[model samples]
Target: MKSEELTGNLHYQIFGLRSLYNLPDSVVKKFELHYASLPDSTIAKDTLLSVIINRKLKNSPYIFLRKKDGEVVTIYMENSQYQQFTKFKYKELIDNKQEVCIKLKAEKLMGRYYKCISVTSVKIKKGQTLGKQGKFLLYEYE
Candidate 1:
């Protein structure tokens, strides 16, 4: 399938709540020294300030694996007793279009450390049409 990266300035909030999900070892190590003096509760909410975007090919029976920059699609078949696969579709909304733009930003909070402060994704005025299919089926967007 043909694909291209469009420009967007969308904003997203990425909160790292330890109660819900633990931060990865690499991330923890990266920020460990910076937040060492902070309380455990505060440390638990490590800031992951970045935006990730991805696209999928039509009729693809694959799983979407998110990465720091983009996404990867993988196809696998396992025994029903061990694993399962599900299909889904995407419904475009009036406020949500296919056009996209992106910008990344980071900042230091409380003069203590630098963290991802903002990620923007805006619509592209001259955006080209993506591969068209019967329906917009994707593994995930966020």
Candidate 2:
């Protein structure tokens, strides 16, 4: 939906929900516990805030979330949209888990970029690529 279609507060709430999804499962549960304690007015500040994590697509990085009424959403906000957050940096990859984890700062600007760590344990066809460059990082395997 276009930014003009939703009220500012409504838009924030939806985007907030998307941000919450980036958090680890434990943190999201804590947020739910706290949110549940707020007044009815605050809890229902935006109807679209009622969303839950849905499945991720196989072999793709996209993550899907669904609302109570079955409306689905993606955690695909652009890097420029949330200045408060950072993207993963190439330097940080060495510290991240072998599978991967998330940081506000990301490695590549577009498509996917993989700075491979273990070349011997796993084999990729010498010329094959695991990821691409893109405007955003859809999801990181932690």
Candidate 3:
């Protein structure tokens, strides 16, 4: 699909969440968690926050939660229109227990030029993309 199509799909997902959960756009767009806890707990919280933020930046279709047991949990936001597109890819990776390669493309306006970019065949690590260029890291399931 085209980049615009992908972006539209993501926006649809975001708006769907707002409608389904009755959440304000601000809440859906970003989240923060504060804890009053121990050192290890703080570390875990920080790790989880980083993961979520990275995923958001990458335009990944799923939200991840890292449990105290160190297991990463995938939560497909039900309202996301792109959930089906992402779920299938994730399932394939999980079923095979193998890494899936991905490509990322982005465009930026630099002065008078529109610079189009591409990064290809990046690896997935810890359920997130490695070496992909973007704010959010993409992931293949499993």
Clashes of each: 12, 14, 2
lDDT of 2: 0.29
The TM-score that candidate 3 achieves is 0.21
lDDT, candidate 2, 1-142, per-residue tens: 1111110000011122234534667886887688678777664432334322122111122222232343333334333332222333222432342212122222221122111111112111212112334565534422
Query: By how many angstroms RMSD does model 2 differ from the true structure?
Result: 16.2
Which sequence of candidate numbers ranks them by TM-score, best first? 2, 1, 3
Q: Which portions of model 2 miss their true places by more than 4 Å?
A: 1-25, 51-138
Question: How much is 97 displaced in model 2, in angstroms?
Answer: 27
81: Cα error in model 3, Å: 10
TM-score of every model versus the real structure? 0.22, 0.25, 0.21
What is the full ranking by lDDT, best candidate first? 3, 2, 1
lDDT of each: 0.28, 0.29, 0.32
Off by over 4 Å in 1: 1-98, 106-116, 129-136
